[model samples]
Target chain A: MSVKLEFNDETLLCKLNGEIDHHTTLPIRLDIDERIESCRPQTVVLDFSNVTFMDSSGIGLVMGRYKVLNELGGTLEVTGLSDNSYKVMRLAGLDRIANIKKGGSKNGNQ
Target chain B: MVINEFKMTVDSRSVNESFTRATVSAFASQLDPTVEEINDIKTAVSEAVTNCIVHGYKNSVGRIYIGVKIHNDGMVIITIRDRGCGIADIKKAREPLFTTLGGDRAGLGFSVMESFMDKISVRSTINKGTTITLYKKISGRAK
Candidate 1:
């Protein structure tokens, strides 16, 4: 499924669920963009607690969102990433660009 | 979807990369697999075919055979078979950062496949052939 979006005054939280492959990203791209545009929150947090898989498409999705939010003078943060997903983000050098919180619990248990 | 089954054999070539991905993605769509599952299967197949062309055939002339089977439950099993120089060390090839012929390769193909698919297995023989099988459990929702 595409990632779910919930927004507060300062934060737009994306509850990412399921695999992040090529087929699934388009919906997310549209959903998140529309939500962010309407809410225009100061901080966007991507919660990957339920994501089980990812690939290059996932990287592209994240990068595209970051660019969009950055242009609007907004900030982006990623939390609750599984270890494997975290590694993929690191490989793409996203750690330097976004705020990635590292203390999230491991996968499968939660 | 009637569980479409397909078999194809093509010469070792790079230009067919996009075509292969498209075909597989289209077939996978029957499962009503989420966009993520579709993309994962495409990426994994692309990587496997690329590996066959590069490492299996050593960038030389050879043939790669692909077989796809779809189940009613929306699971897909793809097997890539190639008769080329087989993997000397399957374990080493699976390492995240290890590459026998290094360049732009992040050595993440196996990892990506493993992460995307529900199961994967590689069988090879020295100077014989290599076969990589991938299984993806897809959702029943019709796309």
Candidate 2:
């Protein structure tokens, strides 16, 4: 998986591409956390437009990030999730912890 | 009635999760499952394989055996087995949000598999290994 970060004021837009599974979660989590700690964004928006596949590992990635941002008094949002990806998120009950939008800008502002 | 059967043994590595999913999905393609059904199978297979890699081998690099059986009635059966440190408490392991790793793992692997598949059974022996069997009935919408 590859993650591109965009800073929008206090929101850190994370555009994720490829598959998010066990093989990719570790590096993805480290990279995202590193940026979150350095930037301290008020909101972290994960863009899943390009993510073709995700498993339970993706749920852990999102939940782990939620905890990190929550501890900082911030929040996380997910947008542009494909049908399958969104279903996985919902099945894992991630929508309860993070704001889920059907589609939005890469920056997650829309 | 069995239509086809496929089996493979792969290293218990995170990268092989995708391979496991792909291989199962390809075999299920003959039944012409819908996109949602295909996704469900992929997700279920991923959870099983991930369990073998994470909890079974504990990153020690072992081998996981995967078996797929396709039924004439559009049913698919998948079995994943790993010869690693087996689960001491099978009941607790299947619980959602229960994880021994206690880090990035959500412990939702079994739950996801249960939700996606029609039936699931888990058998394990401490210091022996674990075997997970999943069954799904496809709608067979292929034209």
Candidate 3:
């Protein structure tokens, strides 16, 4: 799994690639959490454009990040979800916590 | 008539979860399942294998057995078994958002499996093992 992070003044954009499963979730979680905590951005965007596969573990990843941003008074946005990814996230009720922008990149502009 | 049937065994490790899913999806390809169907199966397989690695073996190396059978009627049956710590309460375990691991687990494994597959059943015995069977009907063949 690969995670690329970009930061502006108030928004942190995370681009995730490869498969996100139980084995990879912890490292990805820690990596993103550390950045979010340090940067303390007003908004965090998770880009899933290159995420080929995700399971329930993806739900935990998003939920964990959501909690982190919420505590920091930061918002979380999800983008670039494939149809399958969107279905899994929706089933886990992640769309309720994070703003889901379909077909967009990390910048939230398609 | 049955189109194909196969069984595989893999180490109960987090790294093997993706392998298990990929194997199942490839095995089910004879049925020409739709992209949605393939995703559903892959997701369900991931959950089962992850359960074996996390909850069953608790990070210890163990063995996970998977069996896949596809029928001419366009139905697939998947069986995942692990000989590790068995679930005491299957009912509570199937409940959505109920996880033994507090963090990084949404407790949606079984829930997602139930939602994706047409039918699912779980059988477990303490100190013995657990077996989860999933059944789904594939619709709309790919040309």
Candidate 4:
């Protein structure tokens, strides 16, 4: 499983690990959406510190989640993004839709 | 000057996305690219491969062809080709946030590829297929 779910207060935290790609996103999307539907939290945070690599698929995952949370009147926060991931997010215009925070760790699990 | 190249064909399935990225990255290892440089190549290749799997062969299974070449001058060239439905409008498709796949897709695959790689070329025929070639230079190579 690439996603680990945790509920803190009214926020749903999804800690993502492994490499995120087109094939792996199906399960991850289902996992996160299931949690969002169950709790309907005020904010859903996608933590990517542990994610080793990401492509445009990661952008799609975040956009899809944002739509889900938006329907529930909840917001989305992206955190723990490595520099490489952070750059991709910015290019996808994610910074405008969600609060994005860079991860403290170096790239590739270092 | 050292030169290396490889070619591969894989099923246009989501499961092969990561594999394609890893394979291309490994071949690029011949240039001894830095972490950042390698990551750039991986991400760019992923976008192209994802396009083949998700967009090119959206409704059916097909074969995806990929070729990579590295020059001692620190340049890497990768070509991803798909024998599936071709894009009608290459310009619009390359636009960021433009996607026909809709749900769960940012339509930024081409943009991401263009961003990570120094240059990108796209060619397609209505019913033929789409072929994309990406170019990037790996800086910081030792003399």
Which tens-of-lDDT digit does each residue in B1-143 have in candidate 2? 88789999999988899988998998898898899999999999999999998889995999999999988888899999999999999999999899999888898999899988999999999989999999999997422
lDDT scores of the candidates, listed in order: 0.77, 0.89, 0.90, 0.88
**Shift of residue B133 alpha carbon in model 2, Å:** 0.6
Give per-residue CA lDDT, model 1, range B32-139, as digits (tens): 777667767877887688788778888597999989998776778999999999999999988765667643344667877787789999999999989999998887
Candidate 3 displacement at residue A78 in angstroms: 0.6
Local error of candidate 2 at residue B80 (angstroms): 0.6
Ranking by lDDT: 3, 2, 4, 1
Model 3, range B52-119, lDDT digits (tens) per residue? 88988895899999999988888899999999999999999999999999998999999999998999
| Candidate No. with top TM-score | 3
Interface RMSD of each: 6.9, 0.9, 0.7, 0.8
- Per-residue CA lDDT of candidate 4, range B29-118, in tens? 877788998899999988898888877888899999999987778888899999888999999999989999777888889899888889
Point out the higher-scoring one by TM-score: 1 or 3: 3
DockQ of prediction 2: 0.83
Clash-forming residue pairs, model 4: none
Off by over 4 Å in 1: A1-110, B141-143
Clashes of 1: 5
lDDT of 2 by residue, A6-108 (tens): 8879999898899989988898899899999999999999888788899989899999999999899999998998778787789888989999866555543
Clashing pairs in 3: none
Fraction of real interface contacts that model 4 preserves: 0.97
Instruction: Return the TM-score for each candidate structure.
Output: 0.59, 0.95, 0.96, 0.94
Q: C-alpha displacement of B24 in model 3, angstroms?
A: 0.9
